[model samples]
Target: MTIDLEILHALSEAFGPPGDESQVRDLLRGRLAPLTDEVWTDVVGNLFALKRAKGESRGRVLVTAHMDEAALMVMQVGGDGLLSVRAAGKTEARGLLGQVVHLGPSRTPGVIGVQPVHLTPHERRQDLPDLGDLTVDIGVDSKDEAAGVVKRGDYAVPAAAFGRLGPLVKGKALDNRAGLVVALALLEGDYPCDLYIAFTAQEGVGARGARVAAYAVEPDLALVVDGVGVDELPDEDEPPPDVRLGEGPVLVLSDTRTLLDRGLSLRLQALAEAHGIPYQVLATRGETSDARGVQAAGAGIPTALVGLPIRYPHLPVSLAHPDDLEAAFRLLQAALSQPG
Candidate 1:
């Protein structure tokens, strides 16, 4: 269940918005071709791989990890070379101000901008700028000049480069990219059930890719692996929560979209304890993952969520511990190496 940090870093930095996931999928396709019995992409760009069971046949097990990142799309360009943008997913507009964004497949660079504080109204000095008032600057003089390299409906994401920072890894798209790396590790595991690993698209938008992939696979059991942020609020604001950066993976019981199956989650917890793999129960809420759409598919499919605790999940410098990711990979490999 160990991961190659170099490959994981590349996956985190690769550009792929909700609908435009070709770049990320291409890299995954290359890596999976050697390890899987069959690897292919669906109409919606979800990457599915199969590792067939050898002897006795068990049910299909779908393990999902989203490929899309929280990003923005170009809405319109202004006469002043500034571009208006729209959210591609549940984008955190507040975190976007003054951040660098990469545009399109070429990775063209741009910066989200707002008026300087000196020009703002005195009463508004302490308030954050509105997303509606924001614009992207690509250094062109006018709208016509900007059209040479930019266009409407292009994808924009945080210009985050991957690297190790002390004991943590910082990069963009860690929310689900961490899950993608964990899923890749399973390709090297001993599969007791027929494993169908899905690197889903459009999860940042609405889990659109997961819904379509689930209908196609129709597995008896599924697991959605995603990254959850560690609460970093000051103690004065609230007492510290159990979630921590260096802690092992977070075992999620429920989220905003669906309440995960308790029996499956308990089984994972019991396995963690028996193997002495450090883990913590996720105490945070108000989040969702691809598991929601998959669990509600035709005839109903039971699913659970495994979380990799991260900090500043959607911002430019999202942070995660490598140990947490390794833990997640090991726990899942062990889970799938048994009968469903």
Candidate 2:
């Protein structure tokens, strides 16, 4: 299968954060409208595209991916041109010391500020700054000046561009953007069932968008695609992540809070085995996925999570392999080529 790297690059670099997905939503709407018979955005900002079957419809299949990424939101502007910020998703303040963010719709450039290490007492140098203590510097000299360029509730995301880095694609928001691109690729194939492609919102803070979409669609089967990064990686001091990058798409059996439908999960594995698609079993114990909301809606629906492992997850520089991306697209295409 020939995967389109250009789509990945565009999506990875798009400006999107939790509770604010208009930028990414516009991009998806334009790209998906021509491919499907119907495309529209719902009340919660979830974008849905539907393509009907050629003949008699067997069943409806809903494939979903979240478009929102973790980011920083402006809370207050200080008198000294300092913009106070907070995490928009699960992103931490530790590795964000020297990061850059583009503020609001204007995309004004700014940097997260910190005290220079040279001035710190030698005994207290190892201490990390709290997220609440960090501020964004937008090159202004006073609070009113800074307010003219930025206001409270303005969203800021890392000013990272998606590009090739040796063997992997690197940029911000690879976690779920990678999955969204893969889902879009599946539209190229024909299927016996009617297909619904949902680009959901607010998945970083919680599965808020997926919850409403699942209930609204009410399909017989649902598949959630995620590009969640590994919690920990293999190293001299730490054990390997439960799932590894470049291996294949992950067939999520269960997450920290939800037990996915066994029948569907096993069916995906069977299809992968039959098609010679390299796959992995992700039994993560610390992170919750969109499955929680999808599986618990109304009378309960069968669901499975098709995941791709990202290197840094929520940071501005998440990395993913092209091989794994193709595997995900092919697996979804072949699995639903005929309805189960």
Candidate 3:
């Protein structure tokens, strides 16, 4: 199946920071309602779409894609109209300086500001600035004015556009949006097992929504569709990245918090190879995803992770290869079609 550009554009451009995923959830729910038998959400904001098996169910199968992205939260509004912020998840202070952001539910425009490098002390100039050294300037002149636009505890996301760059797709939050597109596509096919699609929330924070959704669904097998990062620099050295754009979808072996089901991972790899779909493997021990929570829930679920490699992940805008995106969809479709 080809990628749905309209859905990809909508999901990529929607603002859905950790713990605040209504925008993304709404998009998925509307698309999934017509394709699934049931669509519902939990109190913590996780969206679930279920499509029953065609006949006797082989088993309950679950596939998930998180709805949240790295973001910033306003900690305080300074008297000068600047907003002090803390990272909500994977937001990096180094990438935020001077970056444009949309704040709160209103999507008020703002730009992150930092002290001029030319005026900073020489010794401190080389030091990396932390979140404390940054402030979001909302083009206001007083705290009251800023308060009228934004306030303490409001969330902000990168103000970025979604578009294709040659063979690459560039946009904010491609990390999980790419996965969402695949998960949405899977709903189009009728599988042999009860299929559950979870558009999880708060994944960037700590996979909070995934934990609850896993326990609720209690699928015999779980697969996490998400984004993995690439380390393909022009001059990059040893410990080279195992994942890369255009290469294929990633079959994650292990990450910081989760060790994927080896049998499930191997089955996916075999399917990809047998079907002529390109695929890759990643074993980074420092990275994590919703599988972290899903694998440990309810006596244990056999969980596997399929990832689309992203460039400049967790930044304002990231890049992904459209081919990799399609490969992921094709592979997961094959996996779901197999009789367990």
* True-structure lDDT of candidate 1: 0.87
Q: Candidate 1, which segments miss by more than 4 Å at Cα?
A: none
Candidate 3 local Cα displacement, residue 83, angstroms: 0.4
Clashing pairs in 2: 175-227
TM-score of each: 0.97, 0.96, 0.97
Q: What TM-score number comes out for model 2?
A: 0.96
In angstroms, how far off is 334's CA in candidate 1?
1.1
Candidate 1 lands at a TM-score of: 0.97
**Candidate 3, pairs of clashing residues:** none
Tell me the tens digit of each residue's lDDT in model 2 across 1-340.
Answer: 5678888888888889888899888877878866898888889899999888768888998898999988999999999988999999877887688899899989999999877889989988888888888899999999989877999999999888888888888998888889888988877777888998889998888888888888988989899999756665547777767777899999887877789899998889999999999999977646777777778877888999999988888877888999998998888988778668
Candidate 3 C-alpha lDDT tens digits along 100-120: 999998999999876798899
Across 1-340, the per-residue lDDT of candidate 1 in tens digits comes to 3867788788888898899988899888989987999998999999999998866658799999999998988989899999998888867778898999999766789999877889999998888766667789998989999898789999899988899899888888888888898999899876778999999999987788998899899998999898887877677868787788878989888888788888898898988888888888874478788988888888888898899998988777788899999998888887887746
Would you list the C-alpha lDDT of every candidate in the order shown? 0.87, 0.86, 0.90
Q: Which numbered prediction scores highest in lDDT against the true structure?
A: 3
Q: Rank the candidate models, highest lDDT first.
A: 3, 1, 2
Native-structure RMSD, model 1: 1.3
